[model samples]
Target: MSTDLIFSDATKLAELIRTRAVSPVEVVQAHLDRIGAVNPKLNAIVTVAEGALEAARAAEAAVMAGVALGPLHGVPFSAKDSIDTAGVPTQRGSPIFKGRIPDTDATSVARLKGAGAILLAKTNLPEFSYSTETDNLLTGRANNPWNYDRTPGGSSGGESAAIAAGMSPLGLGTDLAISIRGPAANTGIIGLKATHGRVPMTGIWPRVPRRNWHVGPMARSVRDVAVAYSLLAGADGADGFSTTPLRFDTGVGSSPDQPLRVGWLVEPGFGLIDSEVAATVQKAAEALHGVGCVVEPVRIPALEQENALDIFWRLHRMEVKPAFAAVTAGHEDEMFTISKAMLGEPDTALVDFVRLEQAAERLRDGFAEYFQRYDALLCPVLPIPAHAHGLAEFVINGRTVPATHSLSATVPLNVTGLPGLSIRFGTSRDGLPIGVQLVSRWFAESTILYLASLLETASPVRDLHPDI
Candidate 1:
C-alpha cells in the first residue's frame, strides 16, 4: 500500500469510505500493516484486536450493500488499555491485570464500534494508569517516536505516540491531569481532556472516585479529537454524573471565529518552569494574535496557594491506594517508584478528602469566574520538554524544584474539572516538541476544538513527525 494511506485522518478516512473511494477493509489493513512495521520501535500498542480484519471486511460489505454508515465509518483508532474491549486483554500495564479480558465493551468502546470505527489495538499506560510515563512490566515503556532515549509522557503516552507516528488516526485516553495533554506535548500530537462529565467514563479502569477524572480524546489533529469527542458524548445511566438524559451533540468542540480573549500565564503555578518555556508561551500567544486572538498575561491569584500542590497530590494519592492496592500488592516490584511512593503515603483521610474537595471547589470557582472575562487560558503544558526518565526529581527555571510530581502545569485544570487541551507549539533546541495548553469552561469542548482547528490551519504542527 502507498504510504499516503497512513496520513489519513479519522474524519478524512470516514469521508473516503463514505464516498467508496476506499473500503473499510483497505483502511484497517493499511493500519495493521503500519503497526506491524512501526510498533516494535515505539512499543505503543499492546494488543491488536484479533478479528479486526474480518470486522473491517464485514463493514465494507455492509457499506457496499447500501447499509447506513456511522459518522466514524471505517476510521481506525486505539484505546488506552484502561478502556474495556470485549474479549480483548486489557492489562493496564500491570501484572495484576495481566491476561485479564473484559466480557463486554465499555460505553466508549461500544459507541466507537457502533459508529463503524475499527478498533485497531489497545495502547499501553502506567501501572494501574498511574505515573506520567506509559511503561509497565507487561508492555514495557512506550518510547517517544521522536527520540528513543526519551519518554512519551504518560499515562496516555502510547495513544499520543501512536497518533504521532501515524499508526492510528485517533485514540481514547482517560485523564485527571495531563494524562491526555502531556503526552500530546511530548509526542507532538493533539489531545483533549474534554470537560469533565461531558463524555461517559463508564468503562475506564481504577475508577478513581468521581472527584475530577475524565475520559477524553487524543489524535494527530484537533479535528480528529473533536470528531471522536462528539461521537462519544452522552449521559450513560451507568455513570453517576450521567444523571441527565443522554444528550449527544457536537458539544461545541469545534471553533468559533469571534475574536478570542486569551489569558497567557507562565508563572509555573507551583513548580519551576524551564527558562525557555515562558518564551514559548509568549511566542504561541503571538501566533494566536496573528490569527485574531487577543492575548494578554493574566494573574491567577488562586494558584498562589501554598502547599496547594502537595494537598492535591495527597488527595490523588489517597484515592489511588484503594484503586491500586491489589496491583501494588501483587506486583509492587513492577510498579514505578514514584507510583509506589504515592501508595506509601498515608491513606486519604475523610477530613483530608473533604478539605481537598473544598479547596478544589474554590479553585474552580475562582478560575471559572476569571474565565468569564476571557475566551480561554493559554500556558505551558510542562516545565520542560521530554526529559530523561526516572530522574526521581529535577529543577526548572533555575529554581531548586524538589518534587518529581510538580512538572505538570495542566494538573490544576483536572482539579477544576474543566476542559483542557495541549497542542504543539514548536520544537525545543534539542529538537523535541514543545507545547502549550488551552483551557475553557466546563463542557465547552466545541469552543476549544474550534480554536485549535483555527490555530492548526494558521500555524500548522502537521509537518513535525517522528523519525519512526
Candidate 2:
C-alpha cells in the first residue's frame, strides 16, 4: 500500500486523507516514494519540492470536490532548510544561500499550509542554522536513521533525519540551542520547543537571536505534535516574540488530571552525562512515577554553574554573532567553515553584552523560580547520545567534554523561554535512540504535551521502528 504509506502517522495520515481512504495523490506519491527510497542512505531530503506532486494533485482535487478539508487534510510535511517555502528551495544548508528561494511562507510554513499540510520536503541543516551536527557546504551529512554511524541531531538535523526515516510525517524544526530538542533526541522523534514566543517567527532565517529564536513541531507521533501544535500556535503580527495569546489544549484535558508535580534531573550539575544517558533519564522519571506522576529528584541551581557553557557562549558571541555580520559580507568564500569561524570571531562588548544580559536574567529568574514548585521538568535531551560524525570531542560518562559543551542540556531551554519537549524514552546499548526532555512553564505547551502523553504510554521505545 504505497510501501505501507511510509509508516503512517500524521494522525494516521490525516485519517486516511479524511476518509477518502487515502489519495492526496496517494499521499504525495507515498512521500515521493519515501524520498526515492530512503533519501540515498539518509542524507535526509535536501530539496524535493517543486510543486510537490502538483500539490498532491490539487489535494486530490479537493477530495473529489467535496472541499472542506484542513487539519492536515492531505498530510505530508517536512521543513527546516531554515523554514520559508514559497517557491521551495530554502537552501539554508548554505553555499551562501545557493538557490535560495522564498517569496513567502514560514509563519510555521504558513501555518502548515493553512492546516491541510503537504509541503513534501526541504530538510537538511547546519550551515547558517549553525551546527549541532548536520553538515553543510550545502546539503550533506544527516545519517542516523538509528545509526548510520550516529548523528542525526543538529540544527534540526534534516528535520530529525526526515522524521526518523519514514521520510516525513511531520516536521518544521528550528531551535536556537540543541536545535529542535537535540534532533528530536537524536532521531527517535517527537520534538517541540514551543514557548519562546509560542510559534511565529515570521518568514524565518538568520534572524538573530529573537530571544533564543524558536519554531517547533517535528513528529513521529504525540499525535503528530498535537496536530502540528494546533496549527502552530498564535500571534503572527510578525513575531515580536510572537506576542503570547497561545493556549493549546490537545483534548483529553491535555492529559494531566492531577497527582502531577513531576521534576527529575540526574546531575544537571555541569555536563558529561551518559551512564546509559543517566539510566535513560531515570527511566523517564520512572515512567512518570508509574502514571500518577509526583516524580522527584529536582536540583536546578541555575543549571549547576560552570557558567552553563558560558551562558550559551555569551549568547552566541554577543547576540548570534551579529546576525552573520551582514550575511557573511562579500560571501567569505561561500561561507560554512563553521560559517567562516562564526563570522571571523572577536566582538562581544557593549559591556560584555550587558554582563551577558545580566547572566541571562539570572537564568531567566532561576527558571521562573523553578517553575514555581514544579509541575514539570524532567531533563537530559543531550549530554551524549548520537555522537561521532566529525565530533570535536564528546564522550560523557567516561568524561571527555568540549563539543562546545553539548549545549549543556539544550541551552537552558534557549535561556529560559522554557517549554522544552524531546520524548522517545529508551534504547541505547548501541541500539541508539534514548530521549527525555519535558520542561514546561511559560506557555506550558499543554504541560509538555501532558507529560509527553504520559511518557508515551510508559514507553518501551513506543512502537520502535528504524529498519530503514
Candidate 3:
C-alpha cells in the first residue's frame, strides 16, 4: 500500500485524499518513508521539512471536521533548494550561504502551499543553480535513479530525481536555459518551463538575469503540472517581471476548434542531436499526426543564425557574474566548480552584448513568425539521453561539441520567452529516458500543456518509472 501510494501522481493523491479514502497523515508519511528509503541513494533531497507532518496533521483535522479543502490538500511536494522555503534551509547548493533559511517563501512555493500542498523537502542543485549537472561542494552530487553513474540534469536535477524516484509526487523547479526541461528529460518525468515571467521569480537567486529564469512544476503526470501552473501563473506584484494580467486556463486534454497545426525540428537549429534522439522527435511528430493533429517537419532560420545557446551564454554570463561575485565576495573558497567556472569567464564585450541582445530580439521575432503558421513546435529536449556524470564534452551524430551544446534545444525558448513542456516519449538505446519538448507562443502554456496531455496519453513510454 505504501509503495502504491508513493508512486501515485499528485492529482490522484489529491483525489484519494478528497474522497476520504486516504488520510493526509498517511499520504505524508508514505512520502517521508519513501524519502528515507531512496534519498540516501539518490542524494536528491537535501533537507526534509520538519513541519511536514504537522501540516499534514492539520490537513487531516480539516478533513475530519468536514471543512473545505484546496485542490492539492494533503499532497506532498518538494522544491529545488534554490527556491526559498520560509524557515526551511535553502542553501542554493553552495557553502557560501550554508544553513541559510529565508524569512518568506518564494512566490511559487507560497502558491503551492496555498493550494494545500505540504512542503515535504528541499532538493539538491548545482552551486548557485548554474550548471548542466547537479553537484556542488555543499551537497556533493545527485545521482540519476535510472543509472547511478549518470546524471539527472542540473539546477533542477535534485527535483527531477526526487520525483522520478517517487520521493516526491510533484515539485517546483526553476529553469534558466536547460535547467528544468533537461533534468525532467533525464529522469523520465514531466517538467514545464512556462512562458517566461508567467510564474514570478520572487525569492529565487540571481535576480540580475531574471528575464531568462523561470519557476515551474515538475511531476510524474501532465495533469498535475497543469494544476500547479494554473495556481502559479499570475502576477505576484513583488516580481516586476511577472506582470502578465492574463487569465490562465488549466487546459489538459482539451482540443482546439480547428486542427492544431504543429511543427517538429531536430537539426540545423538545435545543434548536433544524436540519431536516436532525432528519431524520437520524429516519432513524436508521427504520434501527433496519428492523433489527428496537423504535424510536419519545420525549422526557423533565425534559430539557426542566432544560435540561442550562444546568445544565452553571452548575455547571462555578463549579467549574472556580478551577482555571483557579490554573493561569493569574501567566501571565494566556498564556491564550487559551476559557480567558479561561471566567474572565470570574462564579461561580454559592450558591442557584443548589444549585438546579442539584438540577436535575441530577432530570435523572438522568428519564433513569433513561425507560431503564426503553427500552434505548437515539437523538438528534442536534449541531444542525447542522460550522459555519464562530469562530462565536459559530448560526441553526437559523429560531431564533437562542447557540453554547453546541450542547451541548444532549450535556450531558444528562454531567449524568446516562449512556453515549453518536456515529457518522456521514448526510451534510449541504452535503456535511458528520452523526452520531447513541446513549445508554444508566449503566454500559451495552455496550448502546449494541452498538447502534452494528448501526447502523454499517446506516449509509448507512459508511466514507466526507474527501478530504484
Off by over 4 Å in 3: 246-257
Write down the lDDT of every candidate, Cα atoms only. 0.79, 0.81, 0.91
Give all TM-scores, in the order shown.
0.93, 0.36, 0.98
Q: Per-residue lDDT for 224-271 in model 3, tens only?
A: 999998899889998888988648542234356578889999988887
RMSD of each: 2.5, 19.0, 1.5
Output the number of the lDDT-best candidate. 3
lDDT of 1 by residue, 82-111 (tens): 899999888878776789999988888898
- Find the 10 residues in a row with the least total lDDT in model 1: 246-255
Count of backbone collisions in candidate 3:
0
Better of 1 and 2 by TM-score: 1
Report the C-alpha displacement of residue 343, candidate 3, in angstroms: 1.3
- Could you say which candidate leads in TM-score? 3
Residue lDDT tens for model 2, 325-362? 77777877777778678666777777877787788888
- Sort by TM-score, top down from the best: 3, 1, 2
Using lDDT as the yardstick, the better of models 1 and 3 is 3
- lDDT, model 2, position 211: 79
